[model samples]
Target: MAVPVPRQRDTPATESAQATPPAVAHATAPQASLTLLVIEDDPAGGLTVPEILDADRHRIRLRTARNLTEAARLLTQDVHCILLDLSLAGTPGGSGPGAGPGTAGAGTAVADQLAILREVLRIAPRHAVLVLTAEADAERAAEAVRVGAQDFLFRDELDGRLLSRAIRYAVERKRADIAQYKLAESKLRAQENARLERGLLPNPLLEGSDLRFAARYRPGRSRALLGGDFYDTVRTPDGTVHAMIGDVCGHGPDEAALGVELRIAWRALTLAGLCGDDLLSTLQEVLEVERPCEEIFATLCTVDISPDGRRAGLCLAGHPAPLISRPGRRAQLLPYENSGPALGLLPKARWPRRQVELGGAWSLMLYTDGLIEGRIGEGRERLGQDGMVEMINRHLDRGLSGEGLLEASVTEARRLNGGELTDDVAVVLLSRTDG
Candidate 1:
């Protein structure tokens, strides 16, 4: 025998009614219309749902499922909310259609009821859910809400207006929950990217060296902190400062990761006293093993400055030559003749180290090709090495040095192209001042 319970009425006078109507009104305007799915085993037609209208005066569509199996089939994207009857059999034992094995106590009816709600939650994780129960089972109804239902309803108090309002409120609340989850995920990703940037782009190791170092790096990918271009400057114990700049073949995370690996490898090998062709050869081996494909390769430019700061060793492996500027002299590119093929391209490649005289008080700029790949205008003409040298000369004439020079150069390059360049750009400047 079923005990008849007092019906609970949610009206303007009730506290629950006060909080729900405002949310329903706000959510209804944007949604315009909604579909509600009702799951119940009552073939006797004990439940009656009247015609429902949203805030926009549009009818709310309703679908009924005799069981969870049918409910799963009807649970499409258009369905915004689900209403499940708590009296369905087999819910406690997890034998109910589409329900996982029950982990709840088997004998208690209350546990069974909650288990049904849990199954519905598992099935429709994204959709808002409500439970229908006897008016006397108010405690169980509240428990259903705690178990993940958006709201619960007493069958005796059910009416079209109340159910419609509850549906709108539940859908809006679910949407807000999803939005907050995504916001938190985005913040976590940002924090992770910051840590990754620090690891990938380390500070220059130039202690005890009189040379001044400045660098500029910009990834072609939108909203990226690192790119395929990588550079590093370190002064070893031998009083020789090693500077390197390189570019992987593509503009993506994989390429950026490869660039970081190469940079770290270069630093390790440089500190270990490897130089010229030997250093380049070891880096090529590393690339061949770590690269995703055989076709991937990287262009490299390395400069080893002498202890006296009056000379340097330059090595170019299928990369552009560095620009050298001295006081009262025009900026020009270091000779790139007799350069070896890019890393991972030629087997047993020999990268010749060219010793060049760096007169006192000179600045050397080593860069990736992205610096010169920008177009001069909307036309097909690129800002070639000649144009870049001219631009640097103009900036130098204005007394811009160190970081200011690199910033002005990159800014002017972007301005000339009328927008951002489509490749990763890295420019490193090593300057020495004589007392």
Candidate 2:
């Protein structure tokens, strides 16, 4: 029978011996009945452990292991904490069952004494661990805690009450450490997303032009700030304002990255004086080279408003035509005749630029297919171009313009679907007022 060890008062402080582990915020509640795994060198599994009881008087379950191998095999998800005997660290047969003869002879006295506890930590990093030692080995016990154990125990002062309290405290502290790690990880991810959003979204270069530009973009993926939809607006040296919008085939990070590449290439080519079929062909080549696979493609629409704001050139590559609204007439889709296939679909596809008459003082809205693909109700009916036109007309009738108009339109689209749309959406409105 194992004698009941008396509790000691004023144990030496272990803080000065080693750096304390960071205190993490407590995110999860403590377990009801804790399970403790005790690792010792007694092959008979005869380690005497006090019957530990929790705050609610529930007896804590116990499991014992004679070596590191057995301890590792017994370390299951249900085991909340570990009680390791420091003496096992130096036992010749306790290095582990199958551990080579050289394994025990490799480290210094202190290293060998802590090797067992180190192995336990490696196998069960997330679980709380407590080290057990004799009263004479108090310094080494403190060193065990510094190495990674949640706390150290002196066998001389071992009792049911002290052991129970130590187990509870160690479990809680481990939970807080995990929660803090997750919180820090989440914060870092958020910061990275914000940077990506700013880089992916377009900044209109409408300086020295009378065009009033407004845009709205929402990624369909949860917790994502950007998607495969991209757009840009810029005024050239000749005073012609050019705007373009496009969508890649997928809604993943790869697709989004490809969209950014295409947008940047378009802006560079446009500034370099490439337009119409010449521009589209170069962009198709870029897409063919940059896309991850042959099946990936992008639909595009581009509009260049003449300096006078009375005439514009429109080109579509398997993309939706922009909606045009004037002072007197209701909003209508511009002619999409002579549109070519989406980029990467046809090797020698030609996107022909069609001339359109944009009477002075009009608003042109260009968007991806995500806007018109949403269901209006539970029926099979979709909010197609006609529905979107109707919605825009309603918002315009309410005297909405610029930012307000774009926000209201997107909001209404989401509301009509009864929830968030499952595809990325990008919309750009360029309004010109001829004085």
Candidate 3:
């Protein structure tokens, strides 16, 4: 986006009123100091560029480079403009015999010097370039401008006012180019991040079931796409449906990456015909290897509902138990006795799976701790398990189900806390009947 126009002295006819060209335009407004690099081969300093004193006495700072080698070393970001001599072609030591154009063997040297100019342009594409050449060689001067220079100046007519004006224009152009490039890069990065977030969060896969899945997750880290909360559901080969939700500790790209690793492991283990303790034990090993630190852990609740829709086996690893409610029945916590520590805590922790006999028609809710830990009042005590059950009973009385129920619970949690949740929350509902 930053297209730097180099300077070249190659006009077909003189544009100045007299035999010499008029002074280049000066900045209408005062501007900041600028660093300029003058690349020339005249060892005797035959080329008299403007000093601090222009014909009108405007001051300008200047640095000199004899050839491409010096220019390369001085090509820092601070250098605003480069005045390159068309004759001094390649790097100093690298030049061999026959380097210059006029000499019987200088043809290669001339081409090499031109190559040096090309390389300099490649390196400092953001800086303005000016080509200095003899007035007689108008053809090469025009060619130089065509190559990359912004404006060309004849050595014989060079003065303070023209050089100063050229430097100011070059710097302004470079800044515009940089600004445009940054804006384009920002837009591209935002688009890519949005695509990734979509893949990470997906709609529930329970199309045929009466279940309603609702969830909300926000990363504790700033400007992040996803945290470590993950959930998934699948109907097995035998028609039994399995569902799970888990939270990896911390809010970081590493934590999110680990969550993906564990979720994929859980799916693979489930489809491979592993379930209950065996599936979870292998998952613990997976986390032990994949987690960024030993202190990292994950809490998970997995539910395997039978095809008949009358029974389900719930497994917990340091996770809150799922809440259950039947038509005309009070909501209560599912049996959570003998649960195990979260993954990556103990080398051999045991999670005794609990079996619950769901009615012919009932709804079950599983969630991460973020849902229950919000404050109910301006006090230390949290909503906790009991508070959540009471909240669900009230919602059921209003006949809320599926997405509506999940939305109500989350909205109420925020209201109780008086702010957004600080931790990630994931909720999944499984129902056996529409009633």
List ranges where model 3 is wrong by over 4 Å.
Answer: 1-42, 46-169, 194-204, 250-254, 289-296, 308-311, 323-335, 357-365, 369-435
Sort every candidate by TM-score, greatest first.
2, 1, 3
Name the candidate, 1 or 3, with the larger lDDT value. Answer: 1
lDDT of 2: 0.84
Per-residue lDDT tens digits of candidate 3, residues 1-435?
A: 222222222322111111112343343344444667777655445666655432333345566666455567777776778888775643232222333344444344446545656767887888888877768757767777677777677767777777677666766776776788889999999999888877776545565665545565666466777778888887776767888889998877898899888988888898888889999999999999988789999999898988777788889998888899989899999888899899999998888888889978788888888788888778888989899999999999999987789889988988998888777777777766745
The parts of candidate 1 lying over 4 Å away from their true place are 1-31, 68-73, 88-123, 136-143, 221-225, 397-401, 418-420
lDDT of each: 0.84, 0.84, 0.74
Candidate 2: tens digits of C-alpha lDDT, residues 71-102: 66778788899998876644344443323365
Worst 10 residues of 3 by lDDT: 12-21
- Candidate 1, residues 1-435, lDDT tens digits: the string is 222111222211100001224535665444435888887655455667777766565678778776666677888898899888887643332234323364344345566566667778888999999888889878888888888888888888888799889999999999998899899999999999889888889689999999998999999999988899999999999899999999999998899999999999999999999998889999999999999999899999999999999998989999999999999899999988999899999878899999999988999999989999999987999999999999999999999999999999999999999999999999999998876
* Model 2, total clashes: 0
What TM-score does model 3 achieve against the real structure?
A: 0.65
